[model samples]
Target: MDIRTLQEELVQYSKTIGIDKIGFASASPFIELKERLVRQQELGYQSGFEEPDLDKRTNPELVLPQAKSIIAIALAYPSKLKDAPRSTRSERRGIFCRASWGQDYHDVLRDRLRKLEAFLQERVPTCKVKSMVDTGELSDRAVAERAGIGWSGKNCAIITPEFGSYVYLGEMITDLPFIPDKPIEDNCGTCTKCIDACPTGALIQGGQLDSNKCIAFITQTKGFIADQYREKIGNRLYGCDTCQLVCPENKGKDFHFHEEMEPDPEVVKPVLKPLLSMSNREFKERFGSISGSWRGKKPIQRNAIIALAHYKDQSAIDELKKVLIEDPRPVMRGTAAWAIGKIDGESSQEILLNAKNKEKDQDVLNEIEKGLQLITR
Candidate 1:
């Protein structure tokens, strides 16, 4: 088989199947990435959502025996939402990051990779292929960078010259010995915009990120958010886009190429008050299609409460009081207590005083006390 010819054919096939950009890369062990991963782990900067085994993550041979090459693909998502809903004082809204605006990229990219795998198998029946999306053991960004898909940006995202940093990345490991493409040069020279725009200063120096302090990571946690970060999070429901939004390369780079990538304004930026009372089934039915719903409704609802507080939405005081009294989750109840104090309605102090006597959870009681203090102040 002419590996070079097959590589060219695969690139053409990728274009037909809606893959915006594709590149071939050697399937050798990711030595530099392994060192970086180890350093991130040592510094406790990892989001704890990554594949834990370092060896499995770095070595392609472990995932697919005799892996000779990797094929990386990038699909650009729309940066601008068309006719987005307005967030008024009476109807405050929280936003999901652009990455989560469309249908889950995992499913979209996996479908594309499956088609590519079938195409390869038809031509080379004996070839073995393994495909992965974001949650895979292999680092999609590292693979994309190695495949010349893009340069790793200062915000720790793959920044393609054509699509900027708004592209969704996926990769496939194969036994076919395709020639690799040269990596793109890093073009984020002396750019401090992403680092400066980070709400919690999560972006350290340039490329490094402290995931513990990242609003994107914090918004997904299913627990009480620390006081310092509550205000910093603003109206972000699922993920934070401050770093990406401020990138000069990403400026004016909005692509509505894929239909599935189009966002429903109401879904991505829903009213905060309605979200606080949404049932699990309702949450799943409305937001299940989007990637942000993967963490379930608890975290999103929790963030909604924080957003209401950030706005000091007095209109949501009634709903906040209901959640404080009836929500089964202690985290929700406690957060509502805190949000109530922040909102500081006409009767918020009395409501908190009443809940303070019946609340059994020590943490909830503490939050109630905090609420009481805020209302009195």
Candidate 2:
């Protein structure tokens, strides 16, 4: 196979697909991935599936019976106007992560990759092509590093000089053989900013992440968090950006813009009042198209009450009381009870006591008591 000739065509194809960077590498198997997977399993970070042998994902012999090259591409999620704090709920704001601030990259990348693969197959009818995004068993970042796209940061993110670590990575595993680019040296230095700013210690060690300890995981958790972590969740109802914010490599980068992911002007500051009164139908209508909408409304609704509690807003008392009494979800009731305790003074205690006395649900009573403790203490 004329590998160099194909590389040239493929690189240009990637650019035409809107990818900012592209590189090629030999299809060798990963050796370190095993240890990492073992560690993730031990740390209880495995996504409910045991790691199958790494070979199935990284080894060309297994990935594509004749796989000889891996093509990696990066899309810059640059921000244009992100330096400002999230605007108030009444004002238009762009609080999305640099990556998600625009149209869904998954849709963009998958469509483009399919197009590129089709272009290749039209010329080489027998060639095989498979494309994925953080998908399957392959080490996406490892492939990018070996392909000479960029060096890996200590935070476990791949970083390019022009785009920092805010790029989404995807790959095309093909049957054509290509000369692989050499890997780059690490440029993370001694920076510990990402580690220090991680509110939940997601970054436990070099290139190691305990996703369970990850705020992103917590906020997106499918089930209820243990009550212990609830108090620490703060006002954040969706995703957490603390670690990314503190990364030096991300400094001075442009703010990525996209109209779809722009923070809803009505919820930019993520206030508690509008949230407290939202019915399930209203919650669906408001956040239906956004990323956080997938988990449904319980987590955000629970988080709303937590924020109201921390803010100690007396104005939120009546609305919170309504949720505490009317919301079917016990989790929301618990959090709303806490918010009422924080906002209401002496009389609020009486309300909670009355609810506790009348409430038949053990969970609701427990939530009421938790709120009582918050105020009493």
Candidate 3:
């Protein structure tokens, strides 16, 4: 059983099957990552979406007993949207981050992992294997860094020399003692572009992120967006690309290797007003295929309302007013009330006042009051 030969064969097979990059890593406990995660947890910097158990997240052996090596894979996604529809005042649009541009990368990466698993099982009939994508307990970036797939960038993304930071990452843990690849050298030297470009200053210094302030995290929350960050979120409906978009390492790095990763301009940057009133069925039928729709329509619609306000598109006033008056969700109704005031339309004051009188939710009433204040101010 020549593990080195097997590793080489796996690497070659990965490339043949559309994996942009693959590297082997020792499946030892991630010591540094555990410490960092502990600090992040202590500071309340972690996004609640992560697997909560620290030991489970850091120790590979817990996930797969006798885990000896890990295989990390990267699949490049298109950063640039080709032939994107223009956003005009009459038809304002909100942008979904490049990550959610195409078919959910989770599905795309999971399919690749399944293929790799099949290939490995056929070669090593008795060896055990386990795989995970972003949703898994293991940190994909940590595995990728250890596997030499890429260096960890200041934006907290695994930056490959060939694909920049615009790559989806996944890993497979197995009881195969494949030689580990050398970790890549960090290339972010004194470059504060990503940190500076962060609209909400989510990137605290370099590599550290306060998820509470991250627009990417904020866009996923199914509740009222804090007033301070609402304006900063701008037209982002899901996730934020400011950090990656500003990185020098990512310059001229755009890959369209996978057809499934291509962005449909209309879906990724849909008209803002239409999204405000979309039924669940309509929203799913249009956006269910994309990763951004995982949080459902509430957050997207809330951000859409904020986007309309960002544009100060008075034309959306009628739709926003309807949401404020008729929407069942308090978050939707409240956000609409806030957006209406932010827009400061000719009839915004009157509409907000009427909603204020009839609104039962305390939160909605407070938002109505804020809207009234915005109009008078």
Candidate 4:
């Protein structure tokens, strides 16, 4: 079969299989991305979740020796939740960002890539293919942008005019030389809304992020979040969508294309108090399937405490106190202490004092001291 004809067939087949967009790009070194990545490293802007090897990351040849073309795919995910649960004064809720709304995107995208690979293998028996989703060394955004799936927006997301930025990207490197698609024009001209709206100023400049200041990255960390960012984190349990939310392109762009991408309101926006005491089994049973739960329960629970504090929900004090005293993780206990301080300051004085007396962990003790100070002040 002709490579271009096969590419056309693959594009059509992709739509039948739930791929919202598909494009092809030359499997060449990402020269500009390499320099930008080097700059990001020198400035310490990386989130540390990316593949560390720059050589393999920028050069398709390094990832797949015989790579001739790269096929990029995008699957549109739901940006809006139906029947969304509200965070009441009594039952304060913490939110998982839209990116983690339904099923773990890693699993969903991988499934699509697997199907694409299978389709290619069936058509061209000798075709060599290497496929990857977000976790892969290759930058999904870079490949997607090059393939005309979207233009890389100032918010550092691939912004498709069709789906807005509400899409999951994946790619497959193949030996077949498919005709590459023309790159998309930059549609985010003069738009600084995403940059201006970042609560913590994590969007340092257009298309560059200081991951250290990013709430999305912070929420996934195991350690206690720094004092400065804790307040800015607001009610987010996992990830931050401030950049996307502020983008004009994402306005009124909600697609419920895939059933698995549909969000369960209660799961994505759960009551903050119960999360404080949720057992590992309970957390896994409740939230294990979602992408937000990948860092496990500690971060979520910690963020829940912070969210409760952000609301100053006195109703959650008892739960916060319980977490401060009994949670085995120092980060959790410490964060709970801070939340208690923020919530019931004067009223939580005794609780903070008592925890300070018995807490052996220096970090937890420090947090307990901060709690006491909050009460006294």
Per-model CA lDDT versus the true structure = 0.94, 0.69, 0.93, 0.91
Which parts of model 1 have CA positions greater than 4 angstroms off? none
Itemize residue pairs with steric clashes in candidate 1: none
Task: Write candidate 4's Cα lDDT for 1-377 as tens digits.
Answer: 98778888999999998999999999999999999999999999998999999999999988898899999999989888899988788888889999998999999999999999999999998989999998998999999999999999999999999999999999999999999999999998897999999999998989999999999999999897999998899999999999999899999999998999899999999998888888899999999999999989988988888898899988888878888888788988898898888886456988888888898999999998887777745
lDDT of 2 at 84: 47
Q: How many residue pairs clash in each candidate?
A: 0, 6, 0, 0
Decreasing lDDT order of the candidates: 1, 3, 4, 2
Q: Indicate the TM-score of model 2.
A: 0.85
Q: What is the lDDT of residue 273 in candidate 3?
A: 96
Superposition TM-score, candidate 3 onto the true structure: 0.99
Model 2 lDDT tens row, 211-230: 77776667666554657666
**lDDT-superior candidate, 1 or 4:** 1
lDDT (Cα, tens digit) per residue for candidate 1, span 9-59 = 989999999999999899999999999999999999999999999998999
lDDT of the structure predicted as candidate 2:
0.69
Each candidate structure's TM-score, on Cα atoms with residue i matched to residue i, is 0.99, 0.85, 0.99, 0.98
Better of 3 and 4 by TM-score: 3
Per-candidate alpha-carbon RMSD to the true structure: 0.8, 3.4, 0.8, 1.0
